[model samples]
Target: MRIFVCIKQVPDTETKIKLMPDGSGIDEGGVKWIMNPYDEFAVEEALKLKQTAGDATVTVISVGPKKRVADALRTAMAMGADDGIVIDCENSLDSFTTAKALAAAIKKEPACDFVFSGKLAIDDNAGSVSQYLAEFLEIPHVTVVSGFEASSGKYVVTREVEGGTKEIFELTGPAVVAANKGLNTPRYASLPGIMKAKKKPLSELNLSDLGLSSSDAKVSFTNFELPPEKPPVKFIDGDPAAQAKELVRLLKDEAKVL
Candidate 1:
């Protein structure tokens, strides 16, 4: 079996974020970067699948600035990925363009049974890459997957849905899987694993290497801004009936939910 897992390097959640001088992106200076937390689940799931099959190969792939992505690939490899591939993007790409670049790299492989990725990257929180990748690959994709079972070329997966519902799906190989939290506990890289990962075969790629150009990008980032501060809560204090009436009035007049 040939499995491909996509990951991203994102700012550590606790790190304070600041905007760039041009307001087009984040200010990375003094900020710590790590493999996206959600993608860790995806990588762990891929490794588990490979272990279950006993003869499968897992390839870890990502697209980002080369300097930032190198450590991410090394971390994935240390977690037991068989190989690693990094795509050097000249500029940060939106989800669609990123997925396009990833899809092109996956196509370069001889054959792939599965492609797995995190449901969302924490930095942008845009949980759309797997859907776009599936579209580009023209395969079935199950997102927010929390459960999975595989035998032969068939797969059974449970996807988390709104209102605490879990939707089960059955799909065949050559599909995409968007791993979510609770899928599996990610393992830490052991000393030996880290040493071995340092020697693993890693391939670096560029847009030109994939026969892609900047013109292929369909979206652009014009500016970035922090979210507005949340308003303070207001209380309706009065007798029971008066409070109820005031609550209704507030909802209708101020909250606009009526």
Candidate 2:
């Protein structure tokens, strides 16, 4: 069995974010980059599945600018993936463009029985890459997969849904699955694994190599803004009845939500 895991490099969640002066994107000077948190779950799940199969191989793939993307691939390789591939995409790519490029890369590479990715990238949070990539590949796709079982050349998946329900799906080989947060605990890259990762094979490709164009971007970002600061909390002090009245008055008059 062969598995391909799609991963991403993103700003550390706790990193203080600042927009560029022209609002084109985030300022990179002081930013610290790390693998996408959800993608970590996907990688761990792939490794787990590979172990279950006993003879499966895992590969990691990613798209981003030059050095940072290579770093993300190294992280995956350190986590026990067999090999890595990075696509060079300097400019911003919308979900559609990214899916197209990834699909092309998968088609060019050796065949894979399964493709895995995170439910969403924390940076963009579009949460549509797996679906779009599956469409491009013409394969079955399942999202928010918290539990997966493979047998008899088919996979049974438990998908997380709204209202805390799980929808079960069974799919054949050559399918895409986006793992949810509770799928598995991600393994930390140890010192030995990190050193071995340095010697692992890594391949890099450009957009032209996939026959894709920047103009293929269906969505473009022109400006960015941080969310407005939250207002200070207010207190209503008085006897219980008086406080209730005051709260009602404030809600109706100031908040206008009564």
Candidate 3:
């Protein structure tokens, strides 16, 4: 069995975010990018499956630009993926176009029995690419996957819904699942794995090579802008009973919650 895990490059969670002078998007300059968190879970899950399904091979694919996307690929390899493919998109893709690009890559590669991706890219937070890619590839797609089990050429997926509801889906091979957080514990890249990762092959392909065009990406962003700062918070301090009374009064009168 062969599995394709799609990963994305995103801003590090701790990286101080600044808007690019206008409100459209993030300021890329001086920003450090990391793997999309949910993608890590997807990678972890793929690695787990490969371990269970002996003779299975796992491939990590990312659409991005870098002097080298090696760093991201290295991370995946260190986690046990066999090979990597990089689509040189860098900062020029939107959700719709990216999904198409990945679908093209998946088609070219062939032998992909399953595809896994994070539920959303952290920086953009547009959680539509995985579903779109499934659509583009003409395969079943499901999101927010909390648990999954694969066998008999089919997969049973568990997910959470609004208001604490639960949903389950059964999809066959070649389907795509957008993994949710907590799917698995992501392993840290060890010294041995990191060293081996450096030796792993990382192939870079251009947009034309993937048959994806920047023009197909419709959204236009002039620049980024910071959201308005919130006013300072006020606290009411007193004994427990006094605080409870104050809270009740505030909720009823001050906040007009009556």
For model 1, name the residue pairs that clash.
none
Candidate 3 least-lDDT 10 residues: 218-227
What lDDT would candidate 3 get against the real structure?
0.84
Q: What order do candidates take by TM-score, descending? A: 2, 3, 1
Runs with alpha carbons beyond 4 Å of true place in candidate 3:
22-24, 221-223
Residue 14 in model 2: lDDT = 96
Tens digit of per-residue lDDT, candidate 3, span 1-258:
989999988879989987755567776788887888999999998988887777888999888785545578779999878889888865748888888888888888758888899998887798999999999989898889889897877788988889978799888677898999867888887889888887887777878997768889866666466667888876889999999999999999888988
Error of 3 at 194 (Å): 0.8
The lDDT for every candidate, in the order shown, is 0.90, 0.90, 0.84
Residue 196 in candidate 2 has what lDDT? Answer: 96
What are the per-residue Cα lDDT tens digits for candidate 2 across 64-161?
89688889999999989999988898854888999998999999987878999999999889999999999999999999989988876788999989
Q: List the residue pairs that clash in candidate 2.
A: none
- What TM-score does each of the candidates earn? 0.87, 0.93, 0.93
Alpha-carbon RMSD to native, per candidate: 3.0, 1.9, 1.8
- Which portions of model 2 show Cα errors greater than 4 Å? 236-249
